[model samples]
Target chain A: MSRKIVRIAVPVLVLLFLYVPILILALYSFTDATQIGAIRSFTLKNYVTLFSTEELRSMIVGTILLALGAALLATILGTLGAIGSFYSRKRTSSAIATVNQIPVINADVVTGFSLCILLVVVFGVSKDSYIPLVVGHVTLCAPFVYLSVIPKLKQMDSSLYEAAMDLGATPAQALFRVVIPQILGGMVSGFSLAVTLSLDDYFIATYTKPATFDTISTYVVNATRGSQTDIKTALWALSTLIFVLVIVIVGVMNFNSGRAQKKEAEKA
Target chain B: MENNQNIIELKHISRTFEDGFRAVSDFNLEVKRGEFVTFLGPSGCGKTTTLRMIAGFDMPTEGEILLNGQDISKLPPNKRPINTVFQRYALFPHMNIFENIAFGLKLKKMPREEIKKKVKKVLELVDLEGFEKRSVSTLSGGQQQRVAIARALVNEPEILLLDEPLGALDLKMRKEMQIELKAMHDELGITFIYVTHDQEEALTMSDKIVVMSEGKIQQIGTPEDIYNEPQNAFVADFIGESNIFNGIMTGTMQARFAGGHFQCVDDVPEGTQITAVVRPEDIELTAPEQGQIRGKVISVIFKGIHYEITVQSGRYEVVIQSTKSAEVGSVVGMKVEPDGIHIMIAENNTNVFPVDMNRNHRLEFNGTELDTSLTQLIKGSRRNEEHELLDENGEVIDPEKIHIIASIEPQDIRMTDDVDDEQVLIEGTISNLIYKGDHYSYVINTDLGQDFIVDDEYLWNMDDRVGLILPLDKMRFQVKK
Candidate 1:
């Protein structure tokens, strides 16, 4: 009984350590605080101001669009690369996989700085272009997609493709009908990982973005640093909203999975 | 034989993998329509390779495969009118049972209604009619097997290949499926080519059995022929329990071995040497005065139907299966009828010598000319003095020359019993002694840089120096091209 209490208590303490500050920040969204360190009176004035402004809302939209675009492009390219390399010769595929892992394990600042040099100094990319920013996001996200997809490919039965072909399907038909459906779960998980990573990124975005285009992370950093305007409480509202959305999504998935298990048990 | 009646013919098929492994060698067979044939062997004996070649999943490295008299060796599996039930079933987990069975017809662009009708017909044949809507993963192993069969049968191929299809099921389920598969085969009346290593399964289900070992077919015959009339030592030992004795033909229908002379039913000439095989059930236990040989019982095992008894006679232990139980350590006399003894010419001995007879009536062998009578060289040959070893139609024997192959049986090479004489052909030290069920087979490395296998009824210690005696009648010669 004491051991079970320890197991339960350890995880609870860790969750509190991770989430207490986020909870505090969420509570600050309703108050009229001028800075993160100072407590202030609770008010709805910040929400009203946040809605009245178009720039902040546009920043949020821009960040979302960029993340979605990056995830879409990365998933397609990464899933294809994963399948192609799986059929390639063993030595070449392992070499390619090793090169794919460098960006994932490397420091974000190093990756961002090198990509900046490659786009601006090496390729003569202009400062106001979105190409550099979009390319940078795709580059940062594709490796995570590759990591997710290759394991699923390896887990699939190698004979399934031959079995399909033996059953009168051609090579291309077998690939599309049998192989792709088997690995779709891995591709989906890879796409979600890409999107999450893109949304949380600051260094790569800052290095590649033009001065006129401000993402949420860049806007928040710039807003808090200068005296032109105080950091808005609307940021806290956005954080709390995202936290609640994640919790709801997780709860729904768990409930559905449990119900599926019950149905299968009843069936058997 | 009508050409149309032979559904598939493999002519000199050989397969050598890229990794220097010879999986099958010079395999040839003709499968008649509506016949159930099985290739039975231990693992890596090319049984699966042969079945795969017939199904077009694997192509022979060299040779021709004819399906209905047309060469189908170069065709792909889909192009051939053959379907295989893989060892693992290989059912598509992503599809329901209905879609899985309909996949082939759907590819052919058959109408939906017609495809459904055909799939239902096959499902009923396999006794899986109501399993259409269930997911493949939800079904049991036996059900999955039936689905695999139904999927293949629905295609309506000319021939069906099964590669150890029941290997994954439990013992009881496998037995049930075996009966079901045999019944299905009878109803379909399609040619079935099955591959397995289980002798009992092969004997139970097949109309013909091809026994193979080391990538070569040992014997091909019906189940009764393969079990009762095995052609060689390997076949006799593999098919069932047999007590093989090294014997010499003493006279017409008589052989001498095991320190006793017994009457046999073989038609070999007198003074010829042979190996005799007798099944365990063929031996009779009787009184000492009424028996041919007597020995003490070594072990007795109570098998369900019979008592298996091992008797030690000299250095050999002979196993006998009888309905009457015999006490262990009791002395017993054993007798066998004349028909119980099967004599076969021993083949493929290591002590091989090339011999040829000249027109001058002299034999040249091993760089020595021997004065053997010419009558023995050409005796019982198809080509006698008139053809001079040529065919009767004057078609020269390939090179228009006669060559002879002479082999000395290892068991016939006797060691001198503490006496050295001019008949000592070789002196060697015993290198290894392996206790084959009936006798001790010894490997001897001689001073002349040769190895000889000798089956003896007397125990000899390893590394013992012994002089070998090759009896004149034991050295049998056969005509070769």
Candidate 2:
């Protein structure tokens, strides 16, 4: 096989494998039947109904709120951890890094089961409160933020800081005025990565989430469960919205990186 | 410049590392307010160590370093009123030229407008005007070196220490910077202490040259003094091309060598051996039998200005240089005056001390003193002499038991005896001829398969029949020890 054919074939194969269920769900929603591949007819009625439902509105609001809260919190913790660990000769930044990285690698069911035990059983977190879900989502996303920031932090020249200090800049001034500006692009990308991670998290949400709150991911899971339901239109709207969001966020961050690279090249 | 006085005084400075390496011995140096002194030597001679100790990077273990009359031995490098222009020009890569120059002034908290004015002036001083906005990496190597200099000089520190700043530059750039730095020195006069291994750089730029060797200073003087009157053979050989002749002191104004007797100038002890140095330019080539010295040409190299010739006479390989080229395989004579010979005691041989000895070298004949010119000693005595003729067990032969061959070349050799055919003859084959601007050197491979080099007045070609003679002055008594 030609190189181009193989390159296209692999991703297409994975896509075909992934989209089959979603395609079936869409076809059933348009058919006005929620039974898995039970009937095949096209209609927008399910999406219209979804728009009118009060739970859908609340779910969208809750998902946005959760993602923003988790992203903001993760960004702060991860940036601090990265800078502190990277700058110091002896610091515990790596310990926090390892702790967060464990969640990324652990089986989703294992992590969910463990967090459920910790928050609901050990900490006695009430099931109706949003605290356990928010805590779980933040833990899931912080590692992503830390990972994204690390490359940028390491790339920063340490001598610039020394030069600033030698030029009479106070330690704080040198950090903020010199170091922060140089690493700002990384921080932005890390925050964007955190938002993306928090938006897509569902496994942990399913196990430990409060009763009153629902993210879009968990809402989609529950919405597609019933029989004779218009699932296709609803999912298309959801996937398109999500796809656009990802593209926009990723595009802006990459655009920032391009400008920064250009500026660095000119300096060189 | 701080005060119109001594800017630095290093009192008995000595540095020892933790691993038991002594970098510099107990050395003392003083710098005036605006003097440009250069430390010159081969690598690892402790010149850079001395510079670092002054900059407060390396603390001396056993001395007081006073800057402006205050002891600064314990001060850290950053706190001292000095800066270094490193050999690599270690400018901050992240900063532009403007920031690099303004760094020290900014640390001093000078007002922004005044800092800008001063930085601009220094940039102009280094001929780096309009380079304020350029990143350090954008500039060429020479520009970076200049920026490093301006960065240090703009601070107006009491002293500036440069550790081989031009060592990385190419030849043309180096020469240009040397002239420019010397001009800058004349204009600023900021007590510049420069370190380098290039002797010509030291000779061209320094007001004073501190010649160092091993871990100690060999000599300190003006360029003329170091070149013309080196205190020892090491200094003479290190400073310029020299033909050194080792001999025993024959009392008040004379020393005997394999090549001849040298009219000595320095004071000598009662009984000691010394070595005299003759510069190639000071030696003269004459006829084979008529001149005061005799030798056969070994090889000749043509210099643009003169011929550099190596001649083998007696047991010594003497070098003569002149404007005229001579034919190879010919016996040549040489002449040397009293002023041309610089006598110094050899460093080895416990009997050869620095003091002048008796006027006549006395040889002991069965415990009785005999009147013999002490023209020679056992080998391995001069600093240039590396190894001895050893026995099978690798032990040095006892000085009294070995029959040593002798030096045969002198720039001025007069005929004292006829040429013995069976004995060693200066007559042989002409190997090469090199023409220098004012003279020529002839190389002749002898019939004994030994090569002889001679520098003479006449211009001669290859393969000439020549009778050979060895002057008594250039012949050494290599008697059994």
Best by lDDT: 1
Report lDDT (Cα) of residue A19, candidate 1.
94
Question: What is the C-alpha local distance difference test score of candidate 2?
Answer: 0.72
Give the TM-score comparing model 2 with the true structure, all chains together.
Answer: 0.60
Question: Which parts of model 1 are misplaced by more than 4 Å?
Answer: A1-9, A37-39, A43-59, A76-104, A108-143, A146-158, A203-232, A260-268, B1-4, B246-248, B257-259, B269-275, B349-435, B438-481
Sorted into a CAPRI-style docking class, model 1 comes out as acceptable
The digit string of per-residue lDDT tens for model 1 on B1-481 reads 4534989999999999875677999998999998999999878789999988887777899999999899999987778778888888988878999999998889889999999899889999988878889998889999999998998888888899999999999999999999999999999888899999888999999999999975789999999999888887777877778887767889999888766689988888987767788899999987766778888899999999999999987766788999999888888898999999888886655577666666543565533455454444655434556644444464434432677777887778788645366667667887656455566777677765567778786889978988777676778777774
Give the distance in Å from residue B26's predicted Cα in candidate 1 to where it truly belongs: 3.0
TM-scores across all candidates?
0.77, 0.60
DockQ of 2: 0.14
Off by over 4 Å in 2: A1-268, B1-4, B16-22, B213-216, B229-237, B242-247, B257-259, B270-277, B290-299, B302-307, B312-336, B348-481
Q: CA lDDT of A7 in candidate 1?
A: 98
